[model samples]
Target: MNCRKVQYYLSTFSEGSFSSDKLSEVEVHIRNCKSCEREKFILEEILVAVRSLPTKTTPDDFNLKLFNRIYAEQNNPSESYLPTPESSWIRRPIGWVSALATVAVAALITMVFLQRPVGSPDLPLNSPAYSQVESTSPVSTPSGKHVGNRIPVSAYENIIGVSGSASNYRATNVSQVRTLRLADARVESLYVEMMRRLGAEPYPNMLRADTRYYEMRSPFARTGSNGSPLLRNAASTISY
Candidate 1:
């Protein structure tokens, strides 16, 4: 038998569990091979030492301690599987990011509301001003000519047709008035465009002069003539 085969059967031989034929073969190998004989002797010495050592007995409360540990784990599983320090540190930054995002959203909403103009509504083209002008009583000129209230005439109209000097002056005044109206219109358009882009309401001062004129003619005018306290309060609120 080879040394490997002898060693393989060595434990069975020590226990008297090997067949007689295999035992005889292992003994022959160990007797002839010095390495096998030395290994056999060492194994026998180890086995003897192991058998000579005292066997340790479990404590009477060992089962109780194990049962208590299992019960505690079942009662509070989270305590047993608590997050590590590194994981907690990583989560803290995420919480801070969420808080910051919430604060930023709130601030943006507040800013939008602050920028919004109060009580601003879209103005109609055929508003009350045009209607008022159409409904006004007609005025008659000195030459028995009746003119519509909607037509704006120059104060120098009589002289405008009579002399070149008056005509040029009238033309210059009309041009200046047209230029001023055009400039105001341009400014109003720009202000409206800016309000639209910002999602904000238009300011009261940005309204056209005709619109303001008609608004003043409303029954709710701030002159305190209508004897309405509500109108007076509303006018006071919007005066600035």
Candidate 2:
């Protein structure tokens, strides 16, 4: 065996488990190679030093004391509980200032909203006069139910209209819209099958009944087909 192979087995040999053939190889290499012999001597010294380390001995009451301490921690808890010093009064002012800043931001937002003129033309995106509706009416009514019987959502005070004369004008009503029941599972399945026949993957999670009501306002986009930009159709959870 080469010196490298013998060196590889040298550790195993030191542990007293090398095969006779491997040991012979190691012995021959150590005798013939000074470098291998030096390495062997170093390994022996390391093993001896490691074995000579002072062994830790437990006192007769070690287990009792350890268990008692643990029990005391569990029962009393004072030993483990470190009380942090109360923050310095000077430092507290900064925290108060930060809290005031956050509150001020919130107040500013509320004031901006409240100060906004009702019926003013400015409307934000996704501003679907949802405040007009109170809650989604989950009742099962017969077809052709009276419109007044339906729950009323918040209404839009501001009405957007075309710039020209009344007859030449168009208007977008920002109002909460009721979700369409058309996306029912059966209808969705039919749509998926139709798409499959056309060799297109059905939209991901397409079968789920998801609906959203978009803002009723003139599209911010300058260029689009006539005044009506298609509203985003997606599910909207009305927050009370």
Top candidate when judged by TM-score against the true structure: 2
My TM-score estimates for the predictions, one after another, are: 0.25, 0.28
- Please give the CA lDDT of all the candidate structures: 0.45, 0.40
On lDDT, the candidate that comes out on top is 1
lDDT by residue (tens digit), candidate 1, 29-127: 888999988887888899999999999997654543444454355335557775444345336877687557645654654454455442211223365
Q: Write the per-residue lDDT of candidate 2 for residues 59-113, one digit (tens) a residue.
A: 6545434443443453344466644353343378876875576456546544554
Model 2 weakest 10-residue run by lDDT: 160-169
lDDT for position 142 in model 2: 35
Candidate 1, residue 58: lDDT: 76
Distance from true location, Cα of 65 in model 2, Å: 2.1
